[model samples]
Target: MIAGLTWLVGFQLLGELVVRVLDLPVPGPVVGMLLLFAYLRLRRYDDSGSIVIAGSGLLRHLQLFFIPAGVGVVAFASVLGRDVLPVTVAVLGSWFLGLVVVGWTAVGLERLLGRPRDDLGDPPAEAAA
Candidate 1:
C-alpha cells in the first residue's frame, strides 16, 4: 500500500516536473499521462499489477476530483455567460479550422506522393509503349 502511494506520487512529481520545466500549456497530470504513455510504449511494461490496477482505480474515480472545479465554474457562470457568444464562435471556428488544416495537410502530402486515394491523384503520365 505504501509502495503504491509512493509510486503514484513519483509519477505525479515527474509529470509536474516536465510541465513546470518546459512550461507546457497543459496541466501537469496531462503531461504526466503523455509521459507515462511514452514510457509504457518504450518499456513495454504491460502487467495487471499495482501500477495498472491502482492507476485505473484512480482514473475511475477521477471525475469526483473535478467536482470542486465544476463548482468553481458554477460560481463564475455569469462571467462566462457574458462572453459566451464570442467564445463559442472562436472555439467552434478554431476547432473546425484545426480539423480542416490537419486534413488538408495530410491530403496535400499524400497527393504530392501520388497516393491516388481520397481524390489525391498524381499528374497524368505518358502512355506506355
Candidate 2:
C-alpha cells in the first residue's frame, strides 16, 4: 500500500513538473492520470497489482475526499448566495447540454450498430397484421 501510494504521488509530482516546465493549460492531476494509464497499459499490470489495490482502497473511501470541497462550499456560502442565479443557470444548462449530447450519442451508436429500438419490437404493418 505504501509503495502504491508512493507511485501515485510520484506520478502526480512528475506530472506537475512536466506541466510547469511546458507551461501547459491542463491540470497536473489529469496529466498524471494519463501518464499512469499509459504506463499501466505498457506494463500490462494485473488487478492484483499494488497500484490497483491502492486505487481500489482509495475509491472505497472516495466520499472522504469530498470533505474539503464541502468545507469550501460552506466557507464560500455567502459568495455562492450572491451569485446563485448565474450558478443555477450554468449548472442547469450544463446538465441539459450533457443530457442532449448523451441522448444523441446513444441514438447514433444504436443506428451504427444496427440495433432495433426497444419501443419498435415489431414493425407497424406486422403489428397491424
Candidate 3:
C-alpha cells in the first residue's frame, strides 16, 4: 500500500515539476494520471496488489476532497448569489458545447471505424418491410 501511494504521489509531483518547467497550460494532476496510465500499460503490477489497494483506499475517502469546495460555497454564498446568472450561463453553455463536441466526435469515430450509423428513433428496414 505504501509503495502504491508513493507511485501515485511520485507521478503527480513529477507532473507538477514538468508543467512548471515547461510552462504548459495543462493541469499537473491530469499529466500525472496520463503518466500513471502509461506506466501501468507498460509494466505488470506486483502480486501484493499495492496499487489497487492504495487506489481503493483513496477512493473510499473521496468525499473528503469535496468538503473544502462545499465549505467555500457556503462561505461565499452572498457573492455567488450576486453572480448566479453569469455562473448559470457559463455552466449551461459549457455543458451544451460539450454535448455538441461529443456528438461530433462520435460521428467522426463511427465513420473512421467503418461502423453502421445509429438509428435509434427510426424503424429498421426489415421491420418496415
Candidate 4:
C-alpha cells in the first residue's frame, strides 16, 4: 500500500516539476495522470497487480478529495452568493448549448449513416383492439 501510494504521489511530483520547469500552461496533476496512464498501459499486469490494486484502493477514497474544495466554497459563500446570477446563467447556458450541439450531432450522424427516422422510435404497438 505504501509503495503504491508512493507511485501515485511520485508521478504527481514529477509532473509538477515538469510543469514548473517548462512553464507549461497545463496543470501538473493532469500531466501526472497522463504519465501514470501511459505507464500502466505499457506495463499492464506487471508487479503482480500491486499497482492496479493500489490504484483501486486509492480511488476508493476519492470522495475525500472533494472536502477541501467544499471547504473553499463554504469559505467564499458570500462571493458566490454575490455572483450567483452570472454563475447560474453561465452554467445553464453552457448546459443548454451542449444539449443542442449533441442533439444536432446525433441527428447529423444518423442522417449521414442513412438511418430512417422510424428506426429512432420504439417498436410499433399492436393496432388498438
- What are the lDDT scores of the predictions, listed in order? 0.79, 0.90, 0.87, 0.86
**14-93 per-residue lDDT for model 1 (tens digits):** 99998899888888877777777787788876776566777777788889998988898778878876789999899999
Off by over 4 Å in 3: 46-48, 115-129
| Model 1: lDDT to the true structure | 0.79
Off by over 4 Å in 1: 23-25, 88-129
User: Which lDDT tens digits does candidate 3 get at residues 2-110?
Assistant: 8889978999998999899999999998899888778877887554577778978998999999998999877887887678999989999999999999999999998
Clashing pairs in 3: none
Cα shift from native, residue 81, model 3 (Å): 4.5
Candidates in order: C-alpha RMSD to true structure: 8.2, 5.5, 4.8, 5.6
Candidates arranged by TM-score, highest first: 2, 3, 4, 1
Best by TM-score: 2
Candidate 2 vs candidate 3, TM-score winner: 2
Best by lDDT: 2
Q: Worst 10-residue stretch by lDDT in candidate 4?
A: 120-129
Q: Compared with the true structure, what per-residue lDDT tens digits does model 4 show for residues 1-90?
A: 878878888999999998999999999989999988999888775756666778888889999999989899778878776789999899
Q: What tens digits encode model 2's per-residue C-alpha lDDT throughout 1-129?
A: 988988899999989998999999999988899999999999999999989999889889989999988998778878776789999999999999999999889998999999837786666896789
Which candidate do you rate higher for TM-score, 3 or 4? 3
Assess every candidate by TM-score.
0.57, 0.75, 0.70, 0.68
- CA lDDT, candidate 2, residue 35: 95
Q: For candidate 3, what is the lDDT?
A: 0.87
